[model samples]
Target: MTQGPIRLDIAVGYATPRKGLPSAVSFRRWATAALAGRIREADLAIRLVGSKEGRALNRHYRGKDYATNVLSFPADLPEGLPPGVRMPLLGDLVICAPVVAREAREQGKSLNAHYAHLTVHGALHLLGWDHEDSREADAMEQLEREILAGLGLDDPYALPGD
Candidate 1:
Protein backbone atom coordinates (compact mmCIF):
# COMPACT_ATOMS: atom_id res chain seq x y z
CA MET A 1 0.00 0.00 0.00
CA THR A 2 3.03 2.26 -0.09
CA GLN A 3 2.63 2.86 -3.81
CA GLY A 4 -0.30 3.09 -6.16
CA PRO A 5 -1.82 5.19 -8.89
CA ILE A 6 -1.31 8.75 -7.63
CA ARG A 7 -0.93 7.95 -3.98
CA LEU A 8 0.25 11.16 -2.41
CA ASP A 9 0.98 11.59 1.27
CA ILE A 10 1.70 15.24 1.86
CA ALA A 11 3.90 16.16 4.79
CA VAL A 12 4.71 19.71 5.63
CA GLY A 13 7.48 20.92 7.87
CA TYR A 14 9.02 24.28 8.73
CA ALA A 15 6.94 27.42 8.42
CA THR A 16 5.17 26.94 5.13
CA PRO A 17 1.67 28.31 5.42
CA ARG A 18 -0.77 25.45 5.41
CA LYS A 19 -3.69 27.61 4.45
CA GLY A 20 -2.00 28.74 1.28
CA LEU A 21 -1.30 25.30 -0.12
CA PRO A 22 -3.61 23.76 -2.62
CA SER A 23 -6.43 21.91 -0.93
CA ALA A 24 -6.08 18.15 -0.64
CA VAL A 25 -8.87 17.74 -3.15
CA SER A 26 -7.11 19.96 -5.68
CA PHE A 27 -3.69 18.39 -5.11
CA ARG A 28 -5.00 14.89 -5.59
CA ARG A 29 -6.69 15.76 -8.85
CA TRP A 30 -3.75 17.73 -10.19
CA ALA A 31 -1.18 15.08 -9.32
CA THR A 32 -3.31 12.29 -10.67
CA ALA A 33 -3.83 14.05 -13.95
CA ALA A 34 -0.24 15.22 -14.32
CA LEU A 35 1.07 11.70 -13.69
CA ALA A 36 -1.29 10.40 -16.34
CA GLY A 37 -2.58 7.74 -13.92
CA ARG A 38 0.68 5.77 -14.26
CA ILE A 39 1.64 6.19 -10.63
CA ARG A 40 1.23 2.92 -8.84
CA GLU A 41 1.87 4.72 -5.60
CA ALA A 42 3.39 8.05 -4.73
CA ASP A 43 4.23 10.18 -1.69
CA LEU A 44 5.11 13.82 -1.34
CA ALA A 45 6.80 15.66 1.50
CA ILE A 46 6.36 19.35 0.80
CA ARG A 47 8.49 21.45 3.08
CA LEU A 48 8.43 25.21 3.31
CA VAL A 49 11.71 26.34 4.72
CA GLY A 50 13.54 29.61 5.04
CA SER A 51 16.25 30.76 2.72
CA LYS A 52 19.05 29.58 5.00
CA GLU A 53 17.93 25.97 5.06
CA GLY A 54 17.13 26.12 1.39
CA ARG A 55 20.56 27.50 0.64
CA ALA A 56 22.19 24.73 2.67
CA LEU A 57 20.37 22.00 0.79
CA ASN A 58 21.06 23.62 -2.56
CA ARG A 59 24.72 23.85 -1.67
CA HIS A 60 25.04 20.32 -0.34
CA TYR A 61 23.10 18.58 -3.05
CA ARG A 62 23.57 20.81 -6.08
CA GLY A 63 26.80 22.70 -5.30
CA LYS A 64 24.90 25.95 -5.62
CA ASP A 65 25.00 28.40 -2.76
CA TYR A 66 21.70 30.18 -3.30
CA ALA A 67 18.32 28.92 -2.33
CA THR A 68 16.43 27.37 -5.20
CA ASN A 69 12.75 27.17 -6.02
CA VAL A 70 12.66 23.43 -5.52
CA LEU A 71 14.85 20.40 -4.75
CA SER A 72 13.89 16.75 -5.22
CA PHE A 73 15.37 13.73 -3.43
CA PRO A 74 14.03 10.57 -5.03
CA ALA A 75 13.88 7.33 -3.13
CA ASP A 76 16.16 4.39 -3.88
CA LEU A 77 13.49 2.10 -5.13
CA PRO A 78 14.19 -1.24 -6.78
CA GLU A 79 15.28 -1.08 -10.38
CA GLY A 80 13.79 -2.69 -13.48
CA LEU A 81 10.25 -3.82 -14.03
CA PRO A 82 8.72 -7.28 -14.23
CA PRO A 83 5.11 -6.76 -15.09
CA GLY A 84 3.32 -5.40 -12.00
CA VAL A 85 6.34 -4.04 -10.14
CA ARG A 86 5.39 -0.49 -9.21
CA MET A 87 7.57 2.50 -8.38
CA PRO A 88 7.69 3.03 -4.64
CA LEU A 89 9.40 5.39 -2.26
CA LEU A 90 9.20 7.91 -5.05
CA GLY A 91 10.97 10.88 -3.39
CA ASP A 92 10.80 14.16 -1.49
CA LEU A 93 10.31 17.76 -2.63
CA VAL A 94 11.51 20.82 -0.79
CA ILE A 95 10.09 24.18 -1.72
CA CYS A 96 10.97 27.52 -0.34
CA ALA A 97 7.58 29.19 -0.16
CA PRO A 98 9.02 32.63 0.18
CA VAL A 99 11.06 32.14 -2.92
CA VAL A 100 8.10 30.75 -4.80
CA ALA A 101 5.94 33.66 -3.73
CA ARG A 102 8.61 36.13 -4.73
CA GLU A 103 9.09 34.51 -8.09
CA ALA A 104 5.39 34.50 -8.73
CA ARG A 105 5.09 38.14 -7.83
CA GLU A 106 8.07 39.02 -9.96
CA GLN A 107 6.74 37.05 -12.89
CA GLY A 108 3.18 38.35 -12.40
CA LYS A 109 1.74 34.87 -12.04
CA SER A 110 -0.79 33.77 -9.51
CA LEU A 111 0.75 32.19 -6.45
CA ASN A 112 -1.33 29.07 -6.88
CA ALA A 113 -0.15 28.72 -10.47
CA HIS A 114 3.47 28.89 -9.41
CA TYR A 115 2.87 26.37 -6.69
CA ALA A 116 1.17 24.09 -9.16
CA HIS A 117 4.05 24.39 -11.58
CA LEU A 118 6.70 23.59 -8.97
CA THR A 119 4.72 20.69 -7.57
CA VAL A 120 4.31 19.21 -11.02
CA HIS A 121 7.97 19.73 -11.77
CA GLY A 122 9.01 17.91 -8.62
CA ALA A 123 6.57 15.11 -9.22
CA LEU A 124 7.87 14.57 -12.75
CA HIS A 125 11.37 14.20 -11.39
CA LEU A 126 10.12 11.51 -9.08
CA LEU A 127 8.72 9.71 -12.11
CA GLY A 128 12.20 9.50 -13.69
CA TRP A 129 12.07 12.62 -15.84
CA ASP A 130 14.76 15.25 -16.14
CA HIS A 131 15.59 18.38 -18.13
CA GLU A 132 19.34 18.36 -18.50
CA ASP A 133 19.20 18.94 -22.27
CA SER A 134 17.22 21.16 -24.59
CA ARG A 135 15.15 18.29 -25.95
CA GLU A 136 14.46 16.96 -22.50
CA ALA A 137 13.65 20.42 -21.28
CA ASP A 138 11.28 20.90 -24.16
CA ALA A 139 9.54 17.64 -23.45
CA MET A 140 9.27 18.39 -19.79
CA GLU A 141 8.06 21.91 -20.41
CA GLN A 142 5.48 20.68 -22.87
CA LEU A 143 4.17 18.26 -20.29
CA GLU A 144 4.15 21.01 -17.72
CA ARG A 145 2.28 23.33 -20.01
CA GLU A 146 -0.34 20.70 -20.67
CA ILE A 147 -0.67 19.87 -17.02
CA LEU A 148 -1.00 23.49 -15.92
CA ALA A 149 -3.43 24.16 -18.69
CA GLY A 150 -5.62 21.36 -17.46
CA LEU A 151 -5.56 23.13 -14.11
CA GLY A 152 -6.87 26.28 -15.90
CA LEU A 153 -3.66 28.26 -15.82
CA ASP A 154 -1.72 30.00 -18.55
CA ASP A 155 1.55 28.70 -19.89
CA PRO A 156 4.10 29.22 -17.13
CA TYR A 157 6.82 29.27 -19.75
CA ALA A 158 5.11 32.08 -21.63
CA LEU A 159 4.60 34.34 -18.67
CA PRO A 160 5.83 37.85 -19.45
CA GLY A 161 9.44 38.55 -18.47
CA ASP A 162 10.07 34.87 -17.91
Candidate 2:
Protein backbone atom coordinates (compact mmCIF):
# COMPACT_ATOMS: atom_id res chain seq x y z
CA MET A 1 0.00 0.00 0.00
CA THR A 2 1.09 3.53 -0.69
CA GLN A 3 1.95 5.77 2.23
CA GLY A 4 0.57 9.17 3.20
CA PRO A 5 -2.95 10.52 3.00
CA ILE A 6 -4.88 9.70 -0.15
CA ARG A 7 -5.69 12.69 -2.32
CA LEU A 8 -9.24 12.28 -3.53
CA ASP A 9 -11.20 14.49 -5.91
CA ILE A 10 -14.80 13.35 -5.98
CA ALA A 11 -17.86 14.89 -7.61
CA VAL A 12 -21.30 13.70 -6.55
CA GLY A 13 -24.40 14.55 -8.60
CA TYR A 14 -28.03 13.66 -8.11
CA ALA A 15 -30.35 13.02 -11.01
CA THR A 16 -32.90 11.59 -8.62
CA PRO A 17 -34.42 13.07 -5.49
CA ARG A 18 -31.82 13.31 -2.77
CA LYS A 19 -34.24 13.04 0.11
CA GLY A 20 -33.30 9.45 0.98
CA LEU A 21 -29.83 9.20 -0.47
CA PRO A 22 -26.44 9.33 1.23
CA SER A 23 -24.65 12.67 1.37
CA ALA A 24 -21.65 13.50 -0.78
CA VAL A 25 -19.40 13.38 2.25
CA SER A 26 -20.56 9.87 3.06
CA PHE A 27 -19.85 8.72 -0.46
CA ARG A 28 -16.40 10.19 -0.33
CA ARG A 29 -15.73 8.40 2.94
CA TRP A 30 -16.83 5.09 1.49
CA ALA A 31 -14.69 5.57 -1.58
CA THR A 32 -11.73 6.47 0.57
CA ALA A 33 -12.14 3.29 2.60
CA ALA A 34 -12.29 1.21 -0.57
CA LEU A 35 -9.12 2.77 -1.90
CA ALA A 36 -7.31 2.87 1.39
CA GLY A 37 -4.77 0.10 0.76
CA ARG A 38 -5.27 -0.15 -2.99
CA ILE A 39 -4.66 3.31 -4.33
CA ARG A 40 -2.77 6.33 -3.11
CA GLU A 41 -4.83 8.98 -4.91
CA ALA A 42 -7.70 9.25 -7.33
CA ASP A 43 -10.37 11.36 -8.98
CA LEU A 44 -13.89 10.09 -9.53
CA ALA A 45 -17.55 11.03 -9.82
CA ILE A 46 -20.66 9.45 -8.33
CA ARG A 47 -24.03 10.16 -9.89
CA LEU A 48 -27.25 9.23 -8.12
CA VAL A 49 -29.91 8.45 -10.71
CA GLY A 50 -33.53 7.42 -10.94
CA SER A 51 -34.75 4.16 -12.48
CA LYS A 52 -35.31 5.50 -15.98
CA GLU A 53 -31.88 6.97 -16.38
CA GLY A 54 -30.28 3.98 -14.72
CA ARG A 55 -32.08 1.56 -16.99
CA ALA A 56 -31.15 3.48 -20.10
CA LEU A 57 -27.50 3.56 -19.13
CA ASN A 58 -27.51 -0.14 -18.34
CA ARG A 59 -29.21 -0.94 -21.60
CA HIS A 60 -26.91 1.20 -23.67
CA TYR A 61 -23.73 0.08 -22.01
CA ARG A 62 -24.19 -3.45 -20.70
CA GLY A 63 -27.14 -4.31 -22.94
CA LYS A 64 -29.14 -5.13 -19.87
CA ASP A 65 -32.62 -3.65 -19.82
CA TYR A 66 -32.83 -3.17 -16.10
CA ALA A 67 -31.53 -0.70 -13.59
CA THR A 68 -28.75 -2.37 -11.62
CA ASN A 69 -27.51 -1.13 -8.31
CA VAL A 70 -24.23 0.55 -9.30
CA LEU A 71 -22.35 0.95 -12.55
CA SER A 72 -18.63 1.74 -12.80
CA PHE A 73 -16.97 3.43 -15.75
CA PRO A 74 -13.23 3.52 -15.42
CA ALA A 75 -11.28 6.35 -16.91
CA ASP A 76 -9.85 5.78 -20.37
CA LEU A 77 -6.63 7.70 -20.29
CA PRO A 78 -4.53 8.55 -23.31
CA GLU A 79 -2.23 5.84 -24.66
CA GLY A 80 1.07 7.62 -24.24
CA LEU A 81 1.68 9.52 -21.06
CA PRO A 82 5.39 10.07 -20.33
CA PRO A 83 7.12 7.88 -17.75
CA GLY A 84 6.93 8.77 -14.06
CA VAL A 85 3.50 10.28 -14.61
CA ARG A 86 0.33 9.11 -12.84
CA MET A 87 -3.25 9.90 -13.73
CA PRO A 88 -5.47 10.75 -10.82
CA LEU A 89 -8.55 10.41 -12.99
CA LEU A 90 -9.88 7.06 -11.86
CA GLY A 91 -13.46 6.93 -13.22
CA ASP A 92 -17.14 7.52 -12.55
CA LEU A 93 -19.91 5.64 -10.74
CA VAL A 94 -23.64 5.65 -11.42
CA ILE A 95 -25.81 4.49 -8.54
CA CYS A 96 -29.49 3.64 -8.90
CA ALA A 97 -31.09 5.11 -5.82
CA PRO A 98 -34.40 3.33 -6.18
CA VAL A 99 -32.85 -0.04 -6.87
CA VAL A 100 -30.54 0.30 -3.94
CA ALA A 101 -33.39 1.27 -1.65
CA ARG A 102 -35.44 -1.69 -2.76
CA GLU A 103 -32.55 -4.07 -2.35
CA ALA A 104 -31.83 -2.80 1.14
CA ARG A 105 -35.41 -3.31 2.17
CA GLU A 106 -35.59 -6.77 0.65
CA GLN A 107 -32.29 -7.82 2.18
CA GLY A 108 -33.24 -6.43 5.61
CA LYS A 109 -30.19 -4.16 5.63
CA SER A 110 -29.77 -0.60 6.77
CA LEU A 111 -30.07 1.91 3.95
CA ASN A 112 -26.90 3.71 4.80
CA ALA A 113 -25.02 0.46 5.12
CA HIS A 114 -26.19 -0.71 1.75
CA TYR A 115 -25.17 2.55 0.16
CA ALA A 116 -21.79 2.31 1.82
CA HIS A 117 -21.30 -1.21 0.49
CA LEU A 118 -22.24 -0.18 -3.03
CA THR A 119 -20.01 2.86 -2.91
CA VAL A 120 -17.12 0.66 -1.84
CA HIS A 121 -17.94 -1.90 -4.49
CA GLY A 122 -18.04 0.75 -7.20
CA ALA A 123 -14.80 2.26 -6.07
CA LEU A 124 -13.12 -1.14 -6.20
CA HIS A 125 -14.40 -1.50 -9.75
CA LEU A 126 -12.86 1.86 -10.59
CA LEU A 127 -9.60 0.37 -9.38
CA GLY A 128 -9.98 -2.54 -11.84
CA TRP A 129 -11.61 -5.09 -9.51
CA ASP A 130 -14.18 -7.43 -11.00
CA HIS A 131 -16.30 -10.54 -10.27
CA GLU A 132 -16.57 -12.24 -13.61
CA ASP A 133 -15.69 -15.67 -12.19
CA SER A 134 -16.37 -17.56 -8.99
CA ARG A 135 -12.87 -17.09 -7.59
CA GLU A 136 -12.74 -13.44 -8.48
CA ALA A 137 -16.18 -12.88 -7.05
CA ASP A 138 -15.18 -14.50 -3.79
CA ALA A 139 -12.05 -12.40 -3.52
CA MET A 140 -13.85 -9.18 -4.32
CA GLU A 141 -16.61 -9.93 -1.85
CA GLN A 142 -14.08 -10.68 0.86
CA LEU A 143 -12.38 -7.37 0.21
CA GLU A 144 -15.71 -5.60 0.29
CA ARG A 145 -16.58 -7.26 3.58
CA GLU A 146 -13.29 -6.12 5.05
CA ILE A 147 -13.80 -2.58 3.85
CA LEU A 148 -17.36 -2.44 5.10
CA ALA A 149 -16.30 -3.94 8.40
CA GLY A 150 -13.79 -1.12 8.74
CA LEU A 151 -16.75 1.23 8.36
CA GLY A 152 -18.66 -0.61 11.12
CA LEU A 153 -20.98 -2.42 8.75
CA ASP A 154 -22.01 -6.08 8.72
CA ASP A 155 -20.98 -8.51 6.03
CA PRO A 156 -23.01 -7.46 3.01
CA TYR A 157 -22.93 -10.91 1.42
CA ALA A 158 -24.20 -12.72 4.48
CA LEU A 159 -27.54 -14.43 4.25
CA PRO A 160 -30.55 -12.95 5.99
CA GLY A 161 -30.72 -15.58 8.72
CA ASP A 162 -27.07 -16.56 8.79
Candidate 3:
Protein backbone atom coordinates (compact mmCIF):
# COMPACT_ATOMS: atom_id res chain seq x y z
CA MET A 1 0.00 0.00 0.00
CA THR A 2 1.17 3.49 -0.85
CA GLN A 3 1.80 5.90 2.00
CA GLY A 4 0.98 9.55 2.27
CA PRO A 5 3.64 12.20 1.90
CA ILE A 6 5.80 13.30 4.83
CA ARG A 7 6.18 16.87 6.04
CA LEU A 8 9.51 17.45 7.73
CA ASP A 9 10.87 20.69 9.16
CA ILE A 10 14.55 21.16 10.02
CA ALA A 11 15.83 23.71 12.51
CA VAL A 12 19.42 24.65 13.29
CA GLY A 13 19.96 25.86 16.85
CA TYR A 14 23.71 25.84 17.04
CA ALA A 15 25.72 29.05 16.86
CA THR A 16 28.91 27.56 15.47
CA PRO A 17 29.46 27.10 11.80
CA ARG A 18 27.74 23.93 10.74
CA LYS A 19 30.40 22.77 8.31
CA GLY A 20 29.00 19.34 7.52
CA LEU A 21 25.33 19.76 8.29
CA PRO A 22 23.02 17.87 6.00
CA SER A 23 20.77 19.82 3.71
CA ALA A 24 17.05 20.04 4.33
CA VAL A 25 16.43 17.93 1.24
CA SER A 26 18.72 15.22 2.55
CA PHE A 27 17.00 15.22 5.93
CA ARG A 28 13.60 14.88 4.29
CA ARG A 29 14.81 12.09 2.05
CA TRP A 30 16.33 10.13 4.90
CA ALA A 31 13.25 10.53 7.09
CA THR A 32 10.93 9.52 4.29
CA ALA A 33 13.00 6.50 3.49
CA ALA A 34 12.95 5.42 7.12
CA LEU A 35 9.20 5.86 7.36
CA ALA A 36 8.56 3.78 4.26
CA GLY A 37 6.15 0.84 4.81
CA ARG A 38 5.66 2.01 8.36
CA ILE A 39 3.37 4.98 8.46
CA ARG A 40 0.87 6.61 6.16
CA GLU A 41 1.82 10.18 7.04
CA ALA A 42 4.27 12.04 9.24
CA ASP A 43 4.79 15.55 10.53
CA LEU A 44 8.04 15.92 12.37
CA ALA A 45 10.80 18.39 13.16
CA ILE A 46 14.53 17.74 13.03
CA ARG A 47 16.42 20.16 15.23
CA LEU A 48 20.19 20.48 15.00
CA VAL A 49 21.60 21.65 18.28
CA GLY A 50 24.91 22.39 19.93
CA SER A 51 26.29 20.44 22.85
CA LYS A 52 24.83 22.79 25.42
CA GLU A 53 21.29 22.47 24.21
CA GLY A 54 21.71 18.78 23.67
CA ARG A 55 22.96 18.25 27.18
CA ALA A 56 20.21 20.35 28.65
CA LEU A 57 17.52 18.46 26.81
CA ASN A 58 19.00 15.12 27.66
CA ARG A 59 19.38 16.00 31.30
CA HIS A 60 15.89 17.40 31.61
CA TYR A 61 14.17 14.60 29.78
CA ARG A 62 16.41 11.60 30.18
CA GLY A 63 18.28 12.62 33.36
CA LYS A 64 21.63 12.29 31.66
CA ASP A 65 24.27 14.94 32.19
CA TYR A 66 26.19 14.68 28.97
CA ALA A 67 25.14 15.34 25.44
CA THR A 68 24.01 12.32 23.39
CA ASN A 69 23.69 11.74 19.71
CA VAL A 70 19.98 12.01 19.05
CA LEU A 71 16.85 12.45 21.16
CA SER A 72 13.35 11.51 20.01
CA PHE A 73 10.27 13.17 21.50
CA PRO A 74 7.14 11.47 20.27
CA ALA A 75 3.91 13.37 20.23
CA ASP A 76 1.30 12.46 22.76
CA LEU A 77 -1.97 12.69 20.97
CA PRO A 78 -5.20 12.55 22.82
CA GLU A 79 -6.70 9.13 23.12
CA GLY A 80 -10.16 8.11 21.95
CA LEU A 81 -10.03 10.12 18.83
CA PRO A 82 -12.83 9.20 16.52
CA PRO A 83 -12.28 6.43 13.99
CA GLY A 84 -10.54 7.44 10.73
CA VAL A 85 -8.84 10.29 12.50
CA ARG A 86 -5.32 10.78 11.25
CA MET A 87 -2.53 11.86 13.59
CA PRO A 88 0.05 13.23 11.24
CA LEU A 89 2.22 14.75 13.92
CA LEU A 90 4.78 12.13 14.76
CA GLY A 91 7.12 14.27 16.93
CA ASP A 92 10.52 15.90 17.10
CA LEU A 93 14.10 14.70 16.71
CA VAL A 94 16.84 16.66 18.46
CA ILE A 95 20.27 15.84 17.01
CA CYS A 96 23.58 16.98 18.45
CA ALA A 97 25.82 17.88 15.54
CA PRO A 98 29.03 18.00 17.52
CA VAL A 99 28.33 14.66 19.17
CA VAL A 100 27.42 13.07 15.87
CA ALA A 101 30.58 14.36 14.21
CA ARG A 102 32.69 13.24 17.12
CA GLU A 103 31.14 9.79 17.03
CA ALA A 104 31.80 9.48 13.30
CA ARG A 105 35.44 10.37 13.75
CA GLU A 106 35.90 8.05 16.69
CA GLN A 107 34.06 5.19 14.99
CA GLY A 108 35.84 5.60 11.63
CA LYS A 109 32.57 6.23 9.86
CA SER A 110 31.87 8.93 7.32
CA LEU A 111 29.99 11.99 8.44
CA ASN A 112 27.20 11.49 5.99
CA ALA A 113 26.82 7.85 6.93
CA HIS A 114 26.68 8.67 10.62
CA TYR A 115 24.08 11.36 10.07
CA ALA A 116 21.99 9.04 7.94
CA HIS A 117 22.09 6.35 10.59
CA LEU A 118 21.08 8.75 13.34
CA THR A 119 18.32 10.23 11.25
CA VAL A 120 16.93 6.80 10.50
CA HIS A 121 17.35 5.78 14.11
CA GLY A 122 15.52 8.84 15.37
CA ALA A 123 12.73 8.36 12.87
CA LEU A 124 12.33 4.77 13.93
CA HIS A 125 12.00 5.85 17.54
CA LEU A 126 9.29 8.30 16.60
CA LEU A 127 7.51 5.44 14.88
CA GLY A 128 7.29 3.47 18.13
CA TRP A 129 10.55 1.52 17.78
CA ASP A 130 12.76 1.13 20.81
CA HIS A 131 15.78 -0.84 22.06
CA GLU A 132 15.13 -1.10 25.77
CA ASP A 133 16.08 -4.80 25.76
CA SER A 134 18.31 -7.19 23.87
CA ARG A 135 15.54 -8.60 21.69
CA GLU A 136 14.21 -5.16 20.93
CA ALA A 137 17.69 -3.92 20.18
CA ASP A 138 18.30 -6.77 17.76
CA ALA A 139 15.07 -6.12 15.92
CA MET A 140 15.72 -2.39 15.77
CA GLU A 141 19.29 -2.87 14.60
CA GLN A 142 18.23 -5.29 11.88
CA LEU A 143 15.69 -2.85 10.58
CA GLU A 144 18.26 -0.08 10.73
CA ARG A 145 20.73 -2.19 8.77
CA GLU A 146 18.15 -2.95 6.12
CA ILE A 147 17.14 0.70 5.75
CA LEU A 148 20.71 1.96 5.68
CA ALA A 149 21.74 -0.70 3.18
CA GLY A 150 18.94 0.40 0.85
CA LEU A 151 20.53 3.86 0.93
CA GLY A 152 23.95 2.41 0.07
CA LEU A 153 25.31 2.92 3.58
CA ASP A 154 27.37 0.48 5.62
CA ASP A 155 25.87 -1.29 8.63
CA PRO A 156 25.95 1.19 11.48
CA TYR A 157 26.34 -1.61 13.99
CA ALA A 158 29.49 -3.06 12.41
CA LEU A 159 32.32 -3.01 14.92
CA PRO A 160 36.00 -2.61 14.17
CA GLY A 161 36.74 -6.22 15.10
CA ASP A 162 33.86 -7.58 13.01
Query: Quick one: best lDDT, which candidate?
Result: 2
Question: Per-residue lDDT tens digits of candidate 2, residues 1-162?
Answer: 678787888999999988978899999999989998687788889999999999999999899999999999887544644477457888889999999999999999999999999999999998888999999999999999999999999999999888
Per-candidate count of clashing residue pairs (backbone under 3 Å): 5, 0, 0
lDDT of 3 by residue, 105-136 (tens): 99999888999999999999988899999999
Per-candidate TM-score against the hidden true structure: 0.79, 0.92, 0.86
**RMSD from true fold, candidate 2:** 3.0
lDDT for 98 in candidate 1 is 76
lDDT tens digits, residue span 1-162, model 1: 224444556565655556666565555565566666657566666666778888999999899999998888877545544466455556677888778889999998888888788878887887778999999999999999988898888898994855
User: Model 1 segments beyond 4 Å from truth?
Assistant: 1-6, 17-29, 77-87
Candidate that beats the other on lDDT, 1 or 3, i.e. the better one: 3
CA-lDDT, candidates in order:
0.75, 0.91, 0.84
In candidate 3, stretches whose alpha carbon ends up further than 4 angstroms from where it belongs are 1-16, 77-86
Instruction: Tell how far residue 9 is off in model 1, in angstroms.
Output: 3.0
